[model samples]
Target: MQALTRPYGALHCRVDGPSDAPAVIFANSLGTDLRLWDPVLPLLPHTLRYIRYDKQGHGLSTLGGGTDISDHADDAIALIESLADKPVFFVGLSIGGLIAQTVASRRPDLVRAVVLSNTAARLGTVESWQARIEAVVGHGLEHIADAVMERWFAPAFRAKPELALWRNMLTRTPAAGYIAACRALSKADQSAATAALRLPALAIAGDTDGASPAELVEATAALIPGATFHIVPGTGHLPCVENPTAYAAILSPFLKAHAHD
Candidate 1:
């Protein structure tokens, strides 16, 4: 694991594929880390470089104690700047998707394109997130793990033994990190800024996504002038994990057409 300690706490990162090729950077959702993209990475063409990192407090990195989405965006931008000097295709899921939009808005030059999967311009109301904050701060991450899993994956995916692995990932996350991220999502409203972005954008959705369903994701796509949108059937919020093949089918062509050189 490589380490970057600027603009945020130590960020655990990895770069794969050809070093000279165009870069693709992936950020994980809340309660998860860089491993979220593991299944999808190998399926992609190995010609382009792939960058993955655990956001501060999510994996091997320390928490920045930040409570806004911009801080998370800065972490992403910092990593890209530290590693190489070029535009990147930013792909993210859930809160990671929010970070993609935030970064594209703040620093378009650093971004070659963006793929937002199972995310939204605004996630939840202040009261709902506040209640969630209270629940986690008082009870702990395990207290809400099941609910998150239900919303994250389809019912069949939940029945498998592998679901236990994700449950552990959620339960093991530090309460402070989870709560801080929740606070950031709660306050983030990227509708205007996201609409203003003219860069190449794609919004992907899972048909069964209870957190951010296909309809909601489509709405986000409509915000961008020429953004493309696609839906992965029978999956929920985290399509990249539940059905990486289908996710790759959509993502591969987009990268080839837009970012691949």
Candidate 2:
């Protein structure tokens, strides 16, 4: 793992492949860290540089106050500019997708393309997010982690032992950080901004993802002109983990096609 200090806080990251190659950066979903990409990273072509990092307050990264989607974008931009010599293909999941959209919209030159998975323009009902924030604030993340995990995985996945491991990771997340992120998600509005994106974009969703259903993913894909959309079979929100092979089948070709030579 590598560490870089940004204006907001310290970020912990992992890099793979060669520095001279086109860069690909992975931003994880809410409550999870860079480890979420463990299953998919090795499958990426070695010709491209890969970067994965823990968001502020998750994994090895430190917690910072006043975090928002814009702040997250700043962190991503700072990291990319400092670490990669070339422009990058940005990949994000859930709230990470929103952050990627913000970065691409604000700093088009920094992004070569984007892959947004299991995310939405407007995440959810403000009321639902607010309730989640209150739950984490009042009772701690453990109180809601189970509910979150249930929503993240399909019924069959939740029955597996590996799913318990993922749940354990969620249980360890700091309540304050989780709640802060929930607040950010509650206030975020990317509908107009995402629709305006002019870059090559790919939107992927899990067929069973209650958080980001097929209709929402289609709507999001439609917003970006000529964006490609794919739905992973038998998966919910975390397709990268639940159906890594299928996720990579869709992802690898798109990335290979878009990656600069």
Candidate 3:
């Protein structure tokens, strides 16, 4: 429950593994906090340090007036500079993926590689995001929690009692924070920047993800000169949650391959 204070507010952060180890930073999806990586972290090698944090207004962190993807990228850059001795492996999911792309482009020296999970260069259109914004601002997160769950997890996961936990997590997020993130998403298009990235990159997608389909993820991966891509079977948007083993299997090797670079 450590916090890094910035001009806007404090960022809730947690670090694990040895301090001298190589660093791996995780940026989770919208509507989720650092806990999004809980399942996958333990499955990864403990030799590397793991850094996780709540984006402004997502978990325990304050909003700090962030309205675009660059603002979020600023938060990540701050964390990496303060916490790690060297460049790290940056792994982002959903909206976090957009942040990873931005960070890699803006501060390539801070990142050794990037793993984009269940995301694309551009996600949704302005009109669609505007509609979603209206829905949340007018009706609240609970109004769209069910539909979000449908997009977030496979049908089998939705049927289980544990679904309530994730649903509550989504609904409990601050509306102001969520809406700010939506606004950022509406304006972000990283196609050109992503294509220009010369660092190692890995893109992972879920087979049943309705938000960012496998084909779309593959296309984004193709934009990078030598990016690798993989899909976890029978999962939805959050494969690291529904199928951490498979996600770790795909991620661990990539991290190891680039650990010393």
lDDT (C-alpha, whole model) for all candidates:
0.89, 0.86, 0.94
Please give the clash total of every predicted structure, in order.
0, 0, 0
If both were scored by TM-score, which would come out higher, candidate 1 or candidate 3?
3
- Give per-residue lDDT, candidate 2, residue 133: 80
lDDT of 3 by residue, 1-261 (tens): 799998887999999999999999999888999999988999999899999999998989999766799999999999999999999999999999999999999999999999999999999999999999999989999999999999999999889898899999899989999999999999999999999999999999999998899999999999998999999998999999999999999999999999998
Candidate 1 versus the native: TM-score?
0.97
lDDT string, candidate 1, 1-261, tens digits: 798985555889999988788899998988998889888888997788999998877888888865899888889998899776689999988889899999999998899899989998888789999999999989999899899999999998999999999999999988888888999989999999998998888899999998888998899989998999999989998899999999999999999888643
Regions of candidate 1 where Cα sits further than 4 Å from its true position: none
Q: What local lDDT score does residue 128 receive in model 3, on the 0 to 100 scale?
A: 93
Q: How does candidate 3 fare on TM-score?
A: 0.99
Give lDDT for model 1. Answer: 0.89
Candidate 3 global CA lDDT score:
0.94
Q: What is the C-alpha RMSD of each candidate to the true structure, in Å?
A: 1.1, 1.2, 0.6
